[model samples]
Target: MRALMMPHRIVMLAVAAGLVAWIVLTGNWSWLPKYAPMIGQGVWRTIWLLVLSVMIGFSLALPLGLAQASGPWYLARPARAFCTVIRGTPLLLQIWLLYYGLGSLFPGIPWIRESELWPILRQAWPYALLALSLSYAGYEGEVMRGAFASVPRGQIEAARAMGMPRRKIFARISLPLAFHSVLPTLGGETVLQLKATPLVATITVIEIYAVASRVRQDTLITYEPLFLVAAIYLMLAGLIVLGFRWLESRQPRRAA
Candidate 1:
């Protein structure tokens, strides 16, 4: 508990209090009541985008990472190329490519535009989701590839010696350890992904950043809306850190 009162933490608290006081006393919030519902919807959209993208990306990343870490050349080469392309490209460019490039192209395809799923495909959110999911998969795939590789070879040998099936060994041992090893990294990446959510606004997905933009345009007040957005992000990031810390604490600790 004493750790909570360190100099840096105290300074952070003071700064936060100062910000709150300024917002309450000096900032223009007159438009908030009118836009509150929109703001709420925007926040929900941001959260869902982050959650869905991370889930989908992590799911794809497992196979990608496993392939890169342990698969044969044929499989590994493609996996490596996929991750390389995703990681190498700028996320904004990818978003634009998906939204402006692929998105525009979809309508020209006779079968695709006429398909049942075309309605969903034509929406901006789908492209945003795909871009974000691909981005998260690209970065986390590298992390998971390293995590999988970092699992000691001795564990595999031991499992083999015990006559365990390959799938069982991976399911019970390797996968769990690899995931646990990278949990902290996963949390950090989630925060980064949260920050990246604002980019979706470019394609017209009305998330919190978009809501802030609306507020700025309507009220002609820049700092207040942006300040609120920053505060909200900070709160969200803090919650993620706390959640990860709790998860870490739940793991068994080695005694000195």
Candidate 2:
């Protein structure tokens, strides 16, 4: 992966420079102080969205992932299908479908039509979080399935030979080992989900990107707020990378 990406370094650098130049040309740097607070507010919203969505996705994905890996065909097949369908589509469309399409069709339902749930769903946060969680769950489920698959058949057989119950074998050996093997993959998914949070703006979640758009609209300035938002995103992404790297490093590595 590193080798394949090396050639893109210069291209990425050029793009960054061009973006900075555009910002400098179109947006006054001095006004950055004025809009900085609003941009920060947006960043907080972005962070909240990431945290909430990832928590929901991570919690759901574990069971879904395990079931997908080892459950009976009847159970596994539908979970696999659900993951495939969600992963196959763009998240933006998923948000639109949940918030507007199915939302319109189920208008008679209390949650869909006229209750407090309506207030939550009518805004962009719920739909955005739902879409992000579902999207990440699909990818995370694959990661977990692969991790579970990496467990040694011999180990399971030995546990069975020792007369350990299925639950004991899974709880004591399978889950832990699989998790160790898949830590890197899990970390990558988490990081990807973090970056993807900004897409919530498409549904009106008012994430960093949304705030930048608003600032641009209000001030007719092109890029200062955008630059600030990018900086904030970059910082958050860096933190995620570092945190996950630390997690991956701290976990015990499996033997080759």
TM per candidate comes to 0.93, 0.83
Cα-based lDDT at residue 34, candidate 1: 94
- Which window of ten consecutive residues has the lowest lDDT sum in model 2? 103-112
The list of candidate 2 runs beyond 4 A from truth reads: 1-27, 105-107, 110-118, 254-256
Q: Which pairs of residues collide in candidate 1? A: none
Cα error, residue 107 of model 2, in Å, equals 4.4
Residue-by-residue lDDT tens digits, candidate 2, 104-189: 76666764576667666656677777888888888788778777877989999999999999999989999889878877777677
Q: After superposition, how far is residue 243 of candidate 2 from its true place, in Å?
A: 0.3
lDDT of 1 by residue, 69-144 (tens): 9999998999999999998988999999999999878889999988899989978999999999999999998999
Best by lDDT: 1
> Residue 69's C-alpha lDDT in candidate 1?
96
